[model samples]
Target: MKLKFSEGVFECIENPPQFFASLGNLHDATIISVARTAPGGVCFIIGDVFNNFVDFPEYPGEFGAAIILAGSTDCEWTVSASHLFGKKINDFEVFPAHSADAKYRLEIACHAMDRYVMNFDKAEIRIAR
Candidate 1:
């Protein structure tokens, strides 16, 4: 499916790993941490090695990238977002235009062969490290 992010960023992914890595040209993305915010918000940390590309920054090393996930008004989670690490993104829809404070509209979605599901209303991806 097509992954639509803010700022006219859009790309097609052939696999789950490619989906995350393709976010803003991120490389070697690995879930470093996950946390809860607000009343029911979750933050998924994806670490990436940046600045090695030709157009990237001078520094080259691993840094903490941000993928903040939250809900509009009390988001629900059938499965913890933290446990999604290494799970295949079977399918997902990221409405960047409607996403605000991490708002991501859903129409029946799950990743990792239906092993995990997090109802998020807000989502933001920061590829730069």
Candidate 2:
């Protein structure tokens, strides 16, 4: 699927599982499966580590990590990360591209995260966000 986030573009491929974020390369990524971390706290993780395999930094290689975001049932959103290099990986406040409902569907969560991540990492290339 091709997703547009503001001025950024991302090509998401399920095969081999990667998201290409207009960095002139493709990242070997893993979109962490959706899971409920706490009561009413639904989230999806995306980072370099996938299926117990850790992605190492490689020169000339595409980015292997990403920032994750999510909207609460009330439409309030947050941003966090597994690995962000110099940037803080801890959870922080953010605004979703669209309003979220009580349904809490996986597709909606992934789409919201993708939209936020693409814009956040637009200038970041081949780096673990």
Candidate 3:
């Protein structure tokens, strides 16, 4: 199954929440695949990290991730990696495109003790299949 994010909305590609045991916490190690839509939206393909693990704050257990899209002028977004599981991973916020006709850059800001990590990804709006 896949989780899709587009046009400020999130939904599962296939199957339902019952397919997974539970949504794990954030801060867990996970890989997310992002795709750019034609109309300026973003699609994320999040896969499982473990085969039988579930819940948050448990090491080596498999859990999903949460994506919080923020429109911050300060150039940072926050993600709670420790609270991922049984929930949709796609989160989005509206932002200005780099250019009038170009795709919008989705900025991610992860907060740490002293500083933050800034990452940029772009997306377009479209229907999910």
The Cα local distance difference test for each model comes to 0.45, 0.29, 0.32
Residues 1-129 of candidate 2 have per-residue lDDT tens digits of 222232222232221112321321223344544344333343444443221222433233322443232333433234443322123122222222243342222222222343222112111112232
**Lowest summed lDDT over 10 consecutive residues: which window, candidate 2?**
117-126
Largest lDDT belongs to which candidate? 1
Model 2: residues with Cα > 4 Å off, grouped in runs: 1-27, 47-71, 74-129
Tens digits of lDDT, candidate 3, 37-83: 44333333444433223442343433333232222123332434333
Judge candidate 2 at residue 71 and give its lDDT.
Answer: 33
Best by TM-score: 1
Clashing pairs in 1: 102-121, 102-122, 102-123, 103-121, 103-122, 103-123, 104-121
Q: Which scores higher on lDDT, 1 or 3?
A: 1
Q: What's the count of clashing pairs in each model shown? A: 7, 3, 19
What lDDT is reached at residue 118 by model 2?
A: 18
Kindly list the per-residue Cα lDDT of model 1 for residues 1-129, writing each as its tens digit. Answer: 222433223222223334444443342334466677776765555555342232555544445545555564434456666665643333343333244444344321333433333456545555443
TM-scores of all candidate predictions against the true structure? 0.41, 0.24, 0.26
Worst ten in a row by lDDT for model 1: 7-16
List ranges where model 3 is wrong by over 4 Å. Answer: 1-26, 49-129
Residue 65 alpha-carbon offset, candidate 2, angstroms: 6.9
* lDDT of model 3, residue 62: 33
